[model samples]
Target: MLTAQATSTAVSATDIAISLGLLVAVYAVLGLLWLFLVVREISHGPAPAPAGVVEEETLPLPSAGPLLRPAGGPMAGSGR
Candidate 1:
């Protein structure tokens, strides 16, 4: 009876090990599939530049306001 019980326990342990092995294999296959999809996306082309490549001379900006006020204030046209 003792030997039979030991044999049954060994078979149960082997079954558990096989189940765990199959689970690991399934997860590995899923991970590989995800990696292949991500690689396919990155293999298309180069990404856009972080800084713009346009020249400032080609597109001049507007000038800022002058230091003096307009010619219609309380101190305007008085020459003071």
Candidate 2:
């Protein structure tokens, strides 16, 4: 099988170094921005809940009706 090789004139050390430097610079900038955003969020605390909302259920749930009935009552599914 034939193989491909880089010709000296086609790819120069200066070009490679420039691209590598640009890549590193881009990543470094993005990392700093992400870190800044995280620190800012941490400095702020959790938001407050809206007023007038009940902490617990004010009405019984439909499924709870069967369980909450008096024990002596006829069986739930019985025709009686």
> Candidate 2 on 1-80: residue-level lDDT in tens?
33345446687889989999999999999999999999988888666558976656575567756667766765565665
TM-score (C-alpha, index-matched) for candidate 1: 0.40
For candidate 1, give the lDDT of residue 41: 77
What overall lDDT, based on C-alpha atoms, would model 2 receive against the true structure? 0.77
Candidate 2 Cα deviation (angstroms), residue 20: 0.8
| Candidate 2: residue 23 lDDT (0-100) | 97
TM-score of each: 0.40, 0.48
Flag regions of model 2 displaced more than 4 Å.
1-9, 51-80
lDDT of each: 0.75, 0.77
Worst lDDT 10-window in candidate 1: 61-70
